[model samples]
Target: MNRESGRYKGKRIIQGGRTQVRTVLYMAMMSAMQSNPIFKATYQRLLEAGKPKKVAIIACVRKMVVILNSMLRDGTMWDENMAKN
Candidate 1:
């Protein structure tokens, strides 16, 4: 496991390792929101800005992945509040 940005790159979530890919993805995103601080903050911010919860959650997941990519490339940990400007 490559530990770039405090995230396990090349990570995999096994759903029997072969089933329900979309469901697994959605659940994984929800889990990330619940456990990852950056994701949680983004999700809440979206909600506060009048985005629907489902839309916000999806956006959060997309943001999370983008951040992960950036961190992996730059070798940095997830920042809790870096974009508050």
Candidate 2:
């Protein structure tokens, strides 16, 4: 699950990738923070467990990518109950 790494130094979280893809993923993750209860709960749990806000957000985005990949690979639609695991 450790896909992308953002190196932190001073005030920077330096990461290398397509800027557009990163930006889009960030935006989608932000939206999921509000719209998806599972993602929201995971994010809150991460924060409650002492993960940094940015780190938690990135984790959720990674979750999104994994889940989406799974769905496409299995030729199935998203299933909330399935994801609860």
Candidate 3:
């Protein structure tokens, strides 16, 4: 998953989005980091596997976006642990 996109141009990790939509997406990414076990585990695993810390975080954000998009498209509730595998 690639979180580093033109859509996120000029946006820093500490300084997130501009519009409400981007802000919401940024907040969701942060929430996925803090509260989602699967995301947390994936992050830790990536870090342990020698991926850069920032890179891992970005990957997490990208994965979160994909999952959120899928849920909204399918009209399904989020199951936070679904990505644990």
lDDT of 3 by residue, 1-85 (tens): 2346666854344545456776666567677779778888888999999987877877887788788788899888977555553
Each prediction's TM-score against the native? 0.56, 0.82, 0.62
Best by TM-score: 2
Q: Rank the candidates by lDDT, best first.
A: 2, 3, 1
What local distance difference test score does each model get? 0.69, 0.88, 0.74
Model 2 misplacement above 4 A: 1-12
Q: Candidate 1 residues 1-85, lDDT tens each?
A: 2334655465323235435765666688899878877678788989999987777876766676677688899888867664322
Residue pairs clashing in model 1 are: none
In terms of lDDT, the poorest run of 10 residues in model 2 is: 1-10
Best-to-worst order by TM-score is: 2, 3, 1
**Candidate 2 per-residue lDDT over residues 1-85, each given as its tens digit:** 1344576335446478788998899899999999999999999999999999998999999999999999999999989987777
